[model samples]
Target: MANTRPLVAQWSRLGNSSIAACKADIPRPALVSYQTVRHASGKPASKDKDKKKRKTRNTFRQYDLKHAMQFSLIDAMHYIRAFEVGQNPASAKYEMHIRLSTLKNGPVIRNRLRLPHPVKTDFRICVIAPPDSKAAADARAAGAALVGEDDIFEQVKNGVVDFERCICHTDSLQKLNKAGLGRFLGPKGLMPSAKTGTVVKDVGNAVKNMVGGSEYRERMGVIRMAVGQLGFTPDEMQRNITSFMDTLKKDIAQLSDRITKDIHEVVLSSTHGPGLTLNGEFKSANSIPPKELAGPL
Candidate 1:
């Protein structure tokens, strides 16, 4: 906010270095670029120096310590359906589901489902498989509670599934609804029906990982985010940068093709009128673009 140094100059500072190390020792330089810390006061004018707009630069410049400070990351893609940056919230009621599929080399998802002890916490988990044992095995790995016909009926009879702590595993589909598993779970929207991927004979491992939070999902269209604010410690921002970039990289690798088609862009920027963002126009294994979506507009 005060006397910020140019990104290139701040690149060598102990503060930035220390901050980078704290975030699993991520190299600050990799998360961002040197020029990102510095820039002309304003946009580049058509001429070398526009007398009318003296403060602005005629060309694009990178953001560094002097020009940019702080960063934030948000999964705008996962944002609820029908979201727009400046649109009215009343118009949007998001009802989107994130789907994940397994790759040959992807990690085996932990079966255990972790939830807060309170039954009303609303992080409902459904373990589905062709047979009770298969679903149980995956849920067990994730540490999810295992339920048989007995548990399902009680929940339905009581008119509530403990989203906070409830697991159902049954090979018989009829037993579930006949006992009223649907009545309670249906209203809460916790019931695992055959329509959603929840009832797959063998959920691809990626979905299990998603249930575990290690999984990544990429869908079409643009999503926005504001990386950070006007002035933040370099150390304060590296973790976000690292996590965002890592997930993005994994997503790209998972899609050998259609990376750009699915991923429109990657950007980063501050919440104000100025800052640096990766202007990667297209997606490819060679380059990862982090776009600064919103908040800065």
Candidate 2:
């Protein structure tokens, strides 16, 4: 009985010491805190608060051709002049915008026309012909500003294309193609080609035709070109317009093969003016009321 009592007392003391050591080594979770942890509120997040506010964009208002009013050639010119009040009368040009009822992928309508009163007189034409040859001399006499063969090609290669128009004689067309100047001249519409009538057997006649003449081309089913200066008389402007429209119709009839090149609408505009649609016959003085411009002028 005495041995049993001692054994029980020693076991109880060991258990009590082990329990106390365990309690001292363990830490209470309440002492540790997380100050960086975020809590969900009904308000927006902190990241959203740092976002930038969007700004309102400015816009320019322009005249829409869909809502344009049809006017006679003379009336349209006068209206355009009204818009060019503060601008130079001589510097402002009369532009014709012709919309064709043709496919965007249709054949391009490109040609040159000599107006009654030329819109511009300062056209620098470059002629590709043998230097000091009869063709070169004739080109110079016909108002070719630059006339040469190898010299002109070298100048073009050096990126010194000082001419606005280019014409190549049939004999020099091969040389022009071999010079690889198309990379430079094609984009500028200065590459001489038989399609555009810039390639010819008669260099002098071609140069004379190009000088003071306006070239028009179809793009996206529309052909736009400056017809005359805004300072031209309405009669002169009418004649120019007639010559151009007649020539355009004739060219379309002659050139169109797979697709029709019918003109759907023709709009007249100035450098800084709104486009006005042409309603009356291009060759006559017939007047039409402004369908969109309703108020008193």
TM-score of 2: 0.71
lDDT of 1: 0.38
RMSD of 2: 18.6
**Structural similarity to truth (TM-score) of each candidate:** 0.30, 0.71
Q: Give the lowest summed-lDDT range of ten residues in model 1.
A: 110-119
Deviation in angstroms for 286 in model 1? 27
lDDT over C-alpha atoms for residue 139 of model 1: 64
Q: lDDT winner among the candidates?
A: 2
For residues 50-112, what per-residue lDDT tens digits would candidate 1 score against the true structure?
Answer: 666576542223224344322233222212111334544333221112123323233322122
Question: Which pairs of residues clash in candidate 2, taking residues 3 or more apart in a chain or in different chains?
Answer: none
For model 1, state the Cα shift of residue 249 in Å: 17
